[model samples]
Target chain A: MNIALFGKLIQLLIKEKMAYRGDFLLSAFAQIVSYGGEYIVIWLFMKRFPLLAGWTWPEIALLYSFGLLTYAIGASFSFVQMRELEGQVRQGTFDNLLIKPINPYFYLISRGFNLAYVAHITISGAVLIWAIGQLNVQWTLLNWAYVLLAVVSGAMIQAGLLTAIGAATFLWVRAGFLFTIFFRLKEFISYPLPLFGTFIQLLLTIGVPLAFVNFYPAAFLLAHDSAPLPGWAMWLAPLVGPLVYGLGYLLWTSGANKYQGAGG
Target chain B: MDSFELHRYVYKLPVNAFREQLRFCMDLLSVGEFAHKPVRQLSLGQRMRVEIAMALLHEPRILFLDEPTIGLDVMAKDQIRQFLRAVNRKKPTASPGRNLPGRSLPRASLPGALPDERRYGVTTYMMFAVKSFTNQLAYRSEVWLRLLGNLLAILIQVEIWRAVIGSSGQEGASLDQMITYSILNPLLLALLSTNVSEAVDSSLKSGSIATELIRPLSYPLYLLAGSLGLSLYKLAFTVAPAFALAGLLFGVLPPASPMNLLAFVAALLIAMLMSFLLGYLVSLLAFWLMSHFALSWMLGGLITIFSGSFLPLWFYSSGWAAVAEALPFQYLGYVPAAVYLGTMTDEAMWRTLAIGLIWAAALLLLVRWLWSRAVRRLIIQGG
Candidate 1:
């Protein structure tokens, strides 16, 4: 409703943060180093072993890269879910947006920006580039396009998970720690989801659909040598992110209706 | 937009302090050393003002000020209070700019105002008595209660461990042997982790250190005393009940000997001291850093993982084990547990003790230097 107010908010953020150039760079650098180090550790392990539960190096790379991209986008844009909803609720600041003209969810999701998270993109990109060099896959134009689409959709799916958790806060006030459990579960996405046995794979495919963000795409890109999944599943992988996000949005709206306004 | 309303939402309050938030508020209103100085260099009072200012940076709709005036002169307190009042009144008059989640006003009753009437049933009185026993016993009591508490918590834990070991079909490992090893192992591990700065540092920020600092008592002794108090309370209310419930619900084993008990207590005391000092140094870092939360959190994670509280560091690759051994992280929780479990050697115990001392001295010096620097900065800045 007030685009000017939104611009003013952005301006305030930029203006306030501009003075802390050293801090900003230091924070972002630290995040990149720590997360990059973690990724390298995992990657190095995979390289030594060559394959994990039958998934090859490049395929693993795709999964890892896509997961990082989705996570990075989510971290860069809407990572406040990392703190969970309890803080805002406990602080009694959850209603600050309720008095505003715009949707409270938008403001809540974007409120605390962690620019450091974008550093993950750099780390993931390096991993992808290195993996691509090692692999012998012919990159088609459509494959590249699908890759871009997959990244975008993966971001949506990741955001959708967080958004759903954010929405669920209206019902379960203590759902803040539950978000931590979700993030911890994301560690499973770093590998081929199917390797974990049927029950977990089923849960990831349908329940969380996190597998679509990484494993499926990686399987298709690397071909059948490493990945057991069919090529058609690769196309389906890209769709799952958006479909999950749409479903999450539907749930979000339903939950939003329960919000009792700032004064309530 | 009321400061009081904001405070209600953000802080839990029995409002205990060496000097409470009100003192800081009162100081800001007065004309004195604090009034003339910039907040950063004005002693603890001025430091508090700077802290409040920092907290207000994001223009928090609801802000919690914990013990805002712990060591401030009266004049400084008045100014802070006046500043808070002005901020509260003027905040909503201007542009509310960003649309955060909540209104400035709190929606529910303040935590302290609600009466806690739910009783823990028949054991409630016993628990209450256990908690208050130290307070009732008055003279030179810090050491007595502190040692007693540490002794008791370790004993209980060892007893539980012994019971577990006995049932697990490990022969020649008497309840006493198991208790001794369990206590020593955990103590060593706890000591090791105390060597790291993170856990020790954050605990200090809880404002638990101020009472110890202002008192004539040495920092370690005071910490030991407080920890002892906590341990005693934990033993009665936490360990006893936990064991009781565990035993009643499912069968349990008890530890074998009093010597194992003594060794465990000794190691645990050292570990507790190490933990407190570690946190003390970390909190001291706040004087230098904007907020030590992220750094502390990261450090805590590394320590926890390396220390092998989740799983034994021995189970990690030999390389990781070397890394863990090289640092004090393993001493935090794992060593003491391991010692009590009879896993660590006498040589390792001595090494842990020596490392604990080195860490303590290093941290003590660091804290003193940091404190001096912070005080100087506060004096120069006058905030």
Candidate 2:
């Protein structure tokens, strides 16, 4: 990707979004309220139980906020593209992307950067800060580095999943139902994995591997002394995101090759 | 009982009256053979005829037929058209309206011959509602998607509640009650909520609002009627079946008592109307704002939080509860569920119902006032 061109595209989109500032602000507030409502539900539950499966309120908040942060970042870049892939294919617009000099995947991902997800970042960032303040963890340079690495890996995992789902549109023509199911499943990783039964736990861990996106990494950083996962598994969680993302990218390429256009 | 017998029982009609109406319907629609069969076993056209007959059993003043010929063979269409014409000729007072946009007039000449005095009334709104109900039948693919989504949502909630309640063994609310509340919240929201705001916003964007403005009826009311029709359809076809299935699978709690069930139904109706008014109010804001998407989202967020859809009001702090009570959002979801669960006392239920009615009346006025202003703005802007 041309860094300058990507920056210009983002700038232009921002400008366009700003033209309807009132609508943008209202939508952003709505997004904030949506996430805020989820946090409040968690808070209310924490108040009732004091601890969820062995995790405290602030710890759960940290896990959820990290998930939200990475989801927002990934979605800001890829959501529209992923959602519109079917429409573009039906309209023969995907052919234009393939004809471009740039890598089509990167180009598709770079275009249509949604600034509305700033609301997600703001709300989740606040929760993360509050949770950290509540925790007695001794933060060092290594811990901070690990947190940074985990956040990026989480974003990659989200982007990968979305890309793969978008690629499925080539065969299905409309992958919206699949997207909805996956999105609902993604909501599971925001809390402590132990609260779920073994079946769901295994499903999230290995079936879709959403646990590697937020839950396991956060557990390692905050509660390593009593992390639920095996010791090696906790350490290996960060690598799972990139590995899943790489597999998803390969799936997308293969699906792209198989695309014979809507006429076919 | 078959559909015919069930309709008679539900309507509390005398045996002779019910038989006469059923015979008239069957003879008119040529569905006498299918009348004895279960509704589920009927083919689409056969079911449509039965539904039309059932809808006419009450002798409604205005009859609305929405795509009455949809999915029918050519012969079936001709039969339905002939039956409708015969019905129209028999009841001169009841104007039978068919929503056929582009097609030439049928031999019946219903819409064109309707007098000006009969053009606007309760019957017209009822027709709009019926039209909306039938329109939703076309989207068969959405039913599975909606069922899956609702099922997933219920499962997630059940799991979360089980985990939370498991820790303390109990909370502010009992586990069973909480589960019931969670189940009803989404079901009611799905049944009551409307995309009217988005619909109005899109019409405004596409410059179709101009066509609506030229119509004799009030645009907002038209939208409301249409939404009511859509809601009724979903309640019957989607929400009811989904709720039944979910309840069977998850074991939902029944209403606390017969009285509570009555109060819950009343509260639910008021809540749905209030939701429609709120949606209309939000959409009218599109007149001033360039886009309504953000505003609609913001309204959704407010509803999600204040309406207690995500969490029951009892779970909130007293201070937060007071704020929520002061607002109209609680009437949308909380009051009805609370009443059904018998969480609120009889006095509180009455008070909440009273408050809900007041809000509905107030919002209705606001919607009317804002709609006039929106129309004026549209006129000024040449929208």
Candidate 3:
């Protein structure tokens, strides 16, 4: 929670990355290429069969842009710890964090920063903007406020999901494939959620709460008649973020207590 | 550009093993502790046998034996030396030009005499890793099945293209047809190649490469042989069966001419070589970057997209398609697919082939440059 610690971590990360110029640029370019190519598959799919499940091109763009915006925010911030948790637990380095004066969770999350990963955010933003222009939704101040809320809350929900999954690693030590399952589901989620079979749609909406991040918020913004979720559920989309994050924190704290710090 | 050369590079079991054996030759070393355990895990001598057994995995043609016995007691070193000599003499040598130099050493001298075919100018070489009839039988069946599968995929792709285009037309279908033709090929290739390459590339970076590199042959050559061995297995077992299924599911037609068949074969070979070389060059970047997975993932994705594998470059705007043709990606998939469908003329085929050759040459040079630099770094690091 200390502002100084966050500032110090950012400065250290920039300095460490600057020392390795080749890796920095290459890694950035690689991220750009990887994200660009994956989205291109969706683009081509849309181009081939436009208006997927009654969703137009701009609606699809919104899904991608908001989804990615949240992903980047989570990944570049709180969920950084999730990526490293497996290695930290297996190596028994969690004890060092526990002994520190500041919050162990804060230090753990702030330790790694993928500066190169912002390329994804940038590309996704560009695509989103282009799609928004084409869609040309009439935006009032209230609409703008909702859009802002969606962006921030969407990021929280995404990060919270990852944090919760990552915390599970402390309980289930060898959860290697869990990450892959989340990744595949995320890719599937980037598309319209309704195209899925009934069971899958219910699972995604209720179990994973993927709909709250992009699809629901997008349906609100477009104010289109065909949104799958009832009008009342649109209001609930933004709340999902804080709710999940609160639950994730509780789970993470419990998991932290169980750590025997064997590697330490 | 040539598939044969690509085969040489990817299916390099002979060379990779040889290099490892040669390094051990100058100084035979072994440790008995299970890997990932510390060096102190076993008696010093038991470890040497593990080293010898490990070296045997490559089935090296020329093994260098250094002061292998120096660290060991007399009895231990003798047993180790005898093991080395036995492997050296029994190992089979792949074809010379098909192999990188220093790796294609002659089959063993005394214990297993070099086959008579060297006299007839057709070198009789054994596939060094196994010798038992049962093993050979199992391997041949596996290879046959793989080839069958690949052939089946190729046939299915052709039938799909034909259905989209229809018969009796003066020309093959347009860009749509080409894209349809190439859609499944790269996906299958990606599924097969990417994970395996990642595993090997990571192992090479993490010092296990030391075990592979110290053999009689070059490391790259050994990997090439292994890939070819796998590809052969795939072609027999996978491609042929795929062809049969395509024939049954969608009635098949003979190629318009033998020339069409030749062009298809040529294009595939070129594509495979280009893909393998490009893969190797990217893998060598691991020496500079701690992790090459991102690079591999990015490159593999590009090859799938821009290579006209998933979608034809033709579907792209004229400017974009022109840009794609200039790159090596199209030469890997689209060019051959088009030529095989009889959509491309002879002039176009030659042009594509020429572009492919140039790309292959550039990639090979890049690989050599990176490998030399990496080797020097290895020497300095004293790994």
Candidate 4:
């Protein structure tokens, strides 16, 4: 639970990844290209049509960058943890954490601080800055602070989202399928949600609430009258992440408490 | 029956035609308790039970089991022994015997070695092909999830095309054709592209591949057969379901001509072969590559971009589309989709199919040569 211990874990993970320098460099480049290909597809679509849902290519780029930035920041912490949770739960390996004095959730979260997402961060971070520079938004201190805070909130929302999904492993015992669905569902939010129908809009805002991860914040920042549901979410954007994350934490605790010993 | 049932495929095999045998084997082995569960959820003992049930499905004349009761609990071991005894009472089956790599294990005491002949070549090779299908039986959930995702993907793309084309309509493409393109492209990809790279990577790293190469089998041919079987599995589960669901919901157009339909099917067969070779060629790089992450990432990106899987070549700029056309990757996605979309004339479709086969053959030759070098390297490394 200590902050220093968390920092040490991260440092250890980084050092471990850095040991394979050739692997590290080549994979980083490859990941950039892999993700960068999707961006090119979006750009190509834009080439055929000047605007989509009344947003220019740069504007769409800004929205896309928001999703990537938050995803990279969020997944860097929870990707490995969430991905491996089902196996760990099934095998009763999570019991390994119960033996330790430290909080198991914190311990679980620390080990997931993967270094692979460095490439994701770099691409998304660069794209965010470049897109911001391209736009004509006012350079005010309050706006900058909201953007920064919203980015953190977005990351927490993503992390919380995966964590909540991962917690279901306790109940189902085979929750690996949900993470696959999680990825496919993320594609729904990558585009302007307005392009979708009322059903999709309602689903994103209320059902899973992943729209808060990128769409709502982008709308709030750009001062566009987007996010048809929960109109007040724009003003209370900073609270969104913590609220979802709290629910996720609650799910995690209850699921952990329900756990029986190794035999199950 | 759940999609996990073996009765869906192998319809011609009378043993597999009945679900009764499946349940009987499952119950006998005690795997029925966790029949709905994924492979990852199973313990070593539980997995052994599932494999045992699978082997018992066909009522094998001589099941080549090795250490059947190795990791099982005392109860499970007794159950397996009892079942084996019951089976052996009716027909001969495996007994406690060690199998040597060079010798087959079956007859009276030693082994019933099959005389190596070209006549049995196909029957021997078919085992590798069927292996790919059985391997996918572990994850029934993945199949359904992928189907849902596929339909959603096609829906989104069709919607996107609507937005782009607008009321006035597009330049060279109609809304219907574009919708067909959206559905068919992903369908072709789902039905054809088998990730044989991961198979190669694992075999090489784990040294399991040494057994494949040292044997008379052609490793690349082995991979090709596996991929073909995988595509066939996908065709039944993924492609057929998605095609029915998408066609029903969105109303995908029929072929421009009956000839186009013929060409589309032919193109797909060649594309499947072409993709397996391409994937194998890239995966062989792990022999010298630092990490598979780089190769997988790079190859995935390059294929997605150049194959025009995400976007058809027609959607690309004239210059960009031409670049895609120049590469062999186009046959993986664009050609099949384009053929179905009726982008090519009748004769042009035939030409494309011919070219795809040639490319597949050329890639196979290159793979064969590279494998020779790889085998030589393994020998030097004292494999």
Candidate 5:
């Protein structure tokens, strides 16, 4: 909503983050090692076994990267705002937003443009790039543009889900469980969609559409598009991101209205 | 997204401080540069400044703080000292040039009494444990969701293990054993990973570490007892229910035999103590290091791999398994689970248990030494 302000906030966070030069370096190393360990678990297991649902190691890595890339970008901004909503609602402090002259959404998102995710983005981005190379993905201009759009849309899907969850806090203060459930589901999407049973596949595709965040886009990219959803749906990143985020915004508006009407 | 909880706390005040007022406080404290930074990004001095601003934002007549400058450098402590003095002496600023005096006591929350030197008995620590157990009971409404989350975690692991093992059955560990392994990791985690590091870290920050250390009760024992309370609570509520659900939905294999079950129980208790000891060992480093992030983080990685929580030792190459056996981490995660599966040979079980006892004793001695030294430093330097 406010491009300059968002950029400015990001700038300030980076500078502040770098102020702890030694600590940051140590923690970044630890962060990489920690996340790398998670991947190592998968790698170690897969090394001994056959392909999971016919999905190779590199292919699985790509899918996992898509999930991380989307989350890193989306959560780099919206993570704090979304989690903060439940507390604000329960404490009756969200009214500060309604009373403010500035758009609360912009204020909330921009203020938390966390630079902590620099590690996540770099780690995931490297993995995604390496996976793409390993898979020999044809990098046509249109394909490149499509990849970019999918990444962006995947991020929106994450942020939109979080936003809707946050907005629902306006209706019920104890909407925190949704956040936990949403995160657990995010873990599920790191695998190929069809690796799961029909129920889970359906849940990912329709119940929540978490598939669009990684599974489907990844399938489309690798040309192994045997997902539960149709072929064209794999390319729906641009539409889904905004569509979900728009719905979240609508929920926010209505929730805000009810909160104000109740004099809360 | 990392701004301090200052905004939320500020807004939660009975009287909302206008955004303009917040800006004024930020400027006054020279915390202007920190307005958008996450709390984690801030230096000790910077965070202290933000804390001061948070307190001042509500325009409270009296301010109470606990060890605001406890970990600050000389210059930063003096700056905070000067700021508090100035604020205390200044006229009420909510209205300009007011005759009313502002009541501010920055070190007000510091406990006054520190006389008890009597050592606490086991019963006293048990009371502490019971308190810890009841502390978690306040969130009854959230219990079901947490249970569901636990169940979901179990389901994810079960499916992955099934898919991996179903097609290509491994050596001694069959599909049933593998399923049991997947389900047990979460159950053990819920029962044993008591977040001892966080508990100890917070107490250190709150200045309660001084009191706990000075008391005759062994602080580590107290922590162990407290965490034991937490584990029991988890078993009764979260772990037991989730285990039942998982057992019903996706069958978890029973122990290899009656003897294996007995050994498994013994190993589980040992595993609990091992994890708690390791957590305490790392967390106590905060005294010398002031932050335990890197060490605990390193240990977490080691545990994930070496402990067989990520992959059972059976799945690993024999060389890798041998290397894992060389470390104490296997006791924390692998030994108990393996014993339950009856995969561990009788001789191996007895041998591992013996070594595990030695490791536990060694860690207890190490924790006691470090904690005593930490207490000495705290008292001498007034941490």
Candidate 6:
């Protein structure tokens, strides 16, 4: 794909959304309120109980904010594309992507870059900062660098999982249900993974590896020496994102190759 | 000893009359050979014929059908149509009503005469409700998806509550009560939740609102009936099953008293009406707004927090609780669940329910007035 053409597509999408200024603003406000509600729930729970699975209110807030930030960035691109893929596949409109000179996965990802996610990122980033302040963590430059890398990696891991799930539409024809499962599972990592039982902890760690998206990195940043997983696992968080995303891209390509028209 | 016998055993009708009706249905629908098979084992067409036979056994004056031949083969459709025509001929007094507004009118009436006396009325709206119920029934996979999601949500709630209460309980509710409250919270909300806003938004966008206007029924009433049907279907097939499963796994507590159960049920029914009216009012904003997406999200957030879907209003500060009590959102989910849990006294339950009823009435009038204004705007703007 040409960089200029991709930039032009993004610009056009933003312009189209901006055409309905009232609707866009309303939608953005709604996103803020919705994300804020999640935080309020967390805050209320913490108020009721000072500790959630051995994490303080500020510590859990930080984890939740990181999860929200990564999810917002990842879902800004993948969620709508995954939702629309079933219809596109069934209607045979997906063939248009294959015929384009650009890589279909990149095209698909770029086409659905929603600006509304700015609301989520802004709100969650603000919460993260507030949470850091409340916790009074002595942040070194290296710590800040690790936080940045972890955020990028977390976004990749989320986008990769969603892409893999979306790829299933090519084979299953009705893979929308899988997206719901993924969404619910994503909610699991929004808090300390230790809050859950062994089964869920293991599932998030190894089965889906959602822990790398938020829990492990947040635990590391918070310097929770009693973190449930092995000490070495925290250091591996950055690699998980690129590795998972690479596998997801491969899955998308194979699914695209296997794609037949609606007639099939 | 066949399908006829099975119907006889199930319905407890006079054997001779039941046999005659069964034979008539079999002969009319050309499914005589399938009579001996169990209903579950029969093909879709054969089962549909049996269902029609069962429905007509009472021999009511009007017969309502919602997509009676959907998913059937051409031959099956033809045969079913023929059978319905035969039934119409045999009992000319019995009017067979199909749910599609203008389709399946009598052959004697021309296309222009589509607005017959039976075009719109209570029965018609009920038909719409039944149509929605059957429509939901068709999406079996969606039901499973919803069930799985609900179960997972309940599990998460249980985990959260377990962590919060942890060998002690909060004020006004024990751990057992909280668990029961969490399980029933979603059930009550699911029963009241409607897609009216989304439906209205899309219809306005697609210009289908025009067709709805020309129909004999009021557009708002039609939407209300359809949404009611959908909620009922969800309550029966989705919420009840999930509640039962959660109860089995997590040990749900019983209502504190029989009176609480009665009051809870009444409050729940009123809450469904109140929810539909609120959703309808939100949906009406689509007439003036460019899109309802943001409005719906705002409404959802308001309902989630104010209605106390995530946590009980009692947990909030007194000021917040006062605000919640003054609003109608709490009546949608919180009040009914509280009544069931006996968190509210009998007097308090009655007072809250009376307020809910008043809100429903006020919302109904408001929606009706706004609908007229919307219709006028549409006409003036040629929308």
* TM-score per model over all chains: 0.57, 0.79, 0.64, 0.83, 0.80, 0.82
- Candidate with better lDDT, 5 vs 6: 6
Instruction: Tell me the TM-score for chain B of model 5.
Output: 0.69
- Model 3 chain B is weakest, by summed lDDT over 10 consecutive residues, at B116-125
Candidate 1 residue lDDT tens string, A60-136: 77678879878788655555743556666655676675776777666665566555565678778878788878888
Indicate which candidate wins on lDDT.
6
Docking class of 4: medium
Interface RMSD of candidate 1? 11.4
Error of 4 at A138 (Å): 1.4
Mind giving the per-residue lDDT tens digits that candidate 2 earns over B169-272? 45678788878888888888888879898889888887766645544565676788889999998888788888898898777899999999999999988988
Q: Candidate 5 at residue B364, lDDT?
A: 90
DockQ values, each candidate: 0.05, 0.40, 0.18, 0.55, 0.34, 0.53
The DockQ-based order of candidates, best leading, equals 4, 6, 2, 5, 3, 1
lDDT (Cα, 0-100) at A103 in candidate 1: 73
Candidate 1's TM-score: 0.57
Tens-place lDDT per residue, model 3, A80-167, is 5786788888877767789999877777777775576577888888888888888878878987888888888887787788878877
Model 5 chain B worst lDDT run, 10 consecutive residues: B95-104
* Candidate 4 lDDT, A97-143, residue by residue in tens: 87788887888988777788889889988888998998889879988
**Per-residue lDDT of B1-383 in model 1, one digit per residue for the tens?**
12232233223223443124444433443423444353334556555655565345435466655446546666765667667776666566433222122323332223321223332232323333333344434323333433333333344344333333455534434455444444444334323332224423544455433322322223333333444555555455434554454444334344324444554566566666656566656555655665554455445556555655533454455677688777766656666555555455667765666776676667668776776675455335422
Clashes of each: 84, 0, 73, 1, 3, 0
Model 4, residue A119: distance off in Å is: 0.7
lDDT minimum window of 10 residues, candidate 5 chain A: A255-264
Q: What overall lDDT, based on C-alpha atoms, would model 5 receive against the true structure?
A: 0.76
Give, for candidate 1 chain A, the lowest lDDT window spanning 10 residues: A40-49
Candidate ordering by TM-score (highest first): 4, 6, 5, 2, 3, 1
Clashes in model 4: which pairs? B107-B112
